[model samples]
Target chain A: MRLITTYLIGLVFGVGISISGMANPAKVLNFFDVAGIWDPSLGFVMGGALIVTFIGYRYVLKRPTPMLSQTFHLPGRRDLDLPLIGGSAVFGIGWGIAGFCPGGALPALGTGSVDVWIFVAALLAGIVIANIIQAAMARTTQATA
Target chain B: MIETVFTPFQSLFGGALIGLAAVLLMATVGRVMGAAGILSGLLQPQDFQDWSWRAAALVGMISGPAALMLVTGEFPAVQVPVSTTMLVIGGVIVGIGVKFGAGCTSGHGVCGMARLSPRSIAATTTFMLTTGLTVYVIRHILGT
Candidate 1:
């Protein structure tokens, strides 16, 4: 039942991405192009989503616990760390180059483009490498201590 | 150069849909709808109970465009402006970056800001600035 709800939510999210023209790499690239011919449509998309989520979170968090899960799994960290900034910067460069973020890229696979597949594969590889590095760091720390 | 087009209505409408999806997931399963996190969890399954919902969300996401095509008899046109090599490079970096940062646009940009998270705000700002700079370098400075 919970899984079904999540699925439905994902479906709506995908449709929203498609309808918003976010699934199109061209549209996404235009959003970042502040100097050249720019498109502010994605701003509206972000604005619209933010407004809904802003209001929605206020109402929902008051309930103490979620409907299906035992507790809400929100991020608790507050510090502005190196990983956050560096990671975001790296992600941004990639986004600017490819014009496809994770959310935009995933739904785009439905278009049956080979390019999406290549991007997705490379994306997975990146994630795997990061994970391995993280694990190695953890092991090294453990051994040192 | 690609022509710039604006569609405020579509963006708002689609963004609302995305917001609603996020809200639904939060309300129902009590999970933040971060696409990268969801995909990562699916890839690395920490627990047995986690994969089901993650997989379901992905399936739902993939089916979204498919369903749209079925109803409208057409799919939205997509164009990859960058070369395949560029695409792969971007994908890998984004993948690594998201992992290190702990969120992406949906996670930090949408849901994080809503929750008023300082980390998310910082992350989002950093990425936006970097993306703008990257674009400037590529288009204006390098003239690529």
Candidate 2:
């Protein structure tokens, strides 16, 4: 039951991404290209998604526990950290260069494009590297303590 | 360059669908539906229960285009404007950024923002600024 719900959730999200034309890297890049022939479609996409999610989350959170899990897995950190800001900046630079956020890119993988595969491979490598860096940081903090 | 088309209707409808997906995930699994986070979690799952759903989600994500094709009578279109080297560089940066930032567009921009999280708001703002500037520098200054 949990697995089925999870799969359907993903399918709905993927379909949404496809219908929004976000599966196309050029469309995403054009949304960023303000001075050029800018497309406000992505903005509308975000806005629309925000409206629904904003309302939906409020209701969903009202329940004491979710149907399939013991507790909600929301991020609890409230502090603004260097990693958050710096990482986002770096991610933005890459996004502008390639026009693929993980959300949009995941669905694009279905396109079977060699380019998409190459990008995803690098993305996976980056995740591994970041994990290593984070582990080392934790170790250093522990040693200092 | 592929012509940039405005799609207000389709964008809004699709966005709503994405939101519904998020809501559904939250209602059932009690988890935020962040794509990068899901991918990473899939990579390093704590248990079979953890691994199963993430894998299913990814498979569903991959199958999205097929669903779209069924409705639209053609596969959704896509184009890569950058070279292979650029794609790899961008992918790596995005991956690292997503990990360190703790979320990508779906996680931070959509879910976190919906929850009115200060961290997510900050993260979203930071990335939006850089992405715009980077594109300006590349398209205008460098004329790429």
Candidate 3:
């Protein structure tokens, strides 16, 4: 049941994403080429997402407990630390190079683009490496709030 | 209106809609909303017997674009071609990542981080950092 629900949510998000991107691809196109084509479109994409997200968050929080559950599972920590900054930087670098964020990538893949596939390959490898590293670091770092 | 050509309202709009969908799914539907995780679960098919939503979600993921194309008349240009082998390998790796990472970019970055989840923040960051670094090393530094 939980698994199935997760899938639906993802599917909805995926649909929402395509609607968002299909409407404004140039913005997504710009985020990658800071110097070249220089499309700042992704900014708009982020903005649109933030708009929907803010409303959704409020809706979720308004409930004494979530409609599906008793309470919303909000995050505890607020402070942005070293890991946050480092991870964002890494993400930015990847976005700069491949011009594909994971959110954007799936829709891009549906088009059956070769570039999307290659990027997906590299992204998968990156995910695996991170998982391996996380397991190893879990022994020492123990993520602090 | 002139800016519509380049603003990328779609991605953000999509994110927001998904945000709503995610919240609803969790609060109402009791789902977690992880893309990579869901896809992997489908490919593997657990013995436990839980797949209706999973199958539906995957179908939705694949079809959303087509539906959009039906209305917008714009589809992905889809340049660059990779072998079936590469695609399969990539899918497997991503599947493994979902198993270990506990979420996909959508689940963690969009949904979890927005809700201020600490684990999600960590997971999202890890994904971003690795992806960024790898792209640089391969496309620029190493010139793959």
Q: What is the C-alpha lDDT of each candidate?
A: 0.88, 0.90, 0.55
Q: How accurately is candidate 1 docked according to DockQ? A: 0.85
- Which scores greater on DockQ, model 2 or model 3? 2
- The sequence of per-residue lDDT tens digits that candidate 2 reaches over residues A76-125 is 98999899999988888888888899999898788787888888899999
| Top candidate, metric DockQ | 2
lDDT of 2 by residue, B1-144 (tens): 466789999999989998999998999999998998899998899999999999999988888988999988887888888888889999999989999998889999999999999999999999999999988998899998
DockQ-derived CAPRI band for the predicted complex in model 3: acceptable
Please, what are the lDDT tens digits per residue for candidate 3 over residues B1-144?
012245455555666666666666657644555665554455456544435556666565656667667777976343222234434444444544555555655667766766667777777667655654544454456643
Of candidate 2 chain B, the 10-residue stretch with the lowest lDDT total is B1-10
Query: Least lDDT summed over 10 consecutive residues: which range in candidate 1 chain B?
Result: B74-83
Q: Native-contact recovery for every candidate? A: 0.83, 0.83, 0.34
lDDT of 3 by residue, A1-145 (tens): 5555555565566567676653222344344434334455545544565456556766666667755445554535556565544555545444434444555666566665665666667766666666567677886766652
> What residue pairs are clashing in model 1?
none
Model with the higher lDDT, candidate 1 or 3: 1
Which pairs clash inside model 2? none
Candidate 2 stretches with Cα past 4 Å from truth are: none
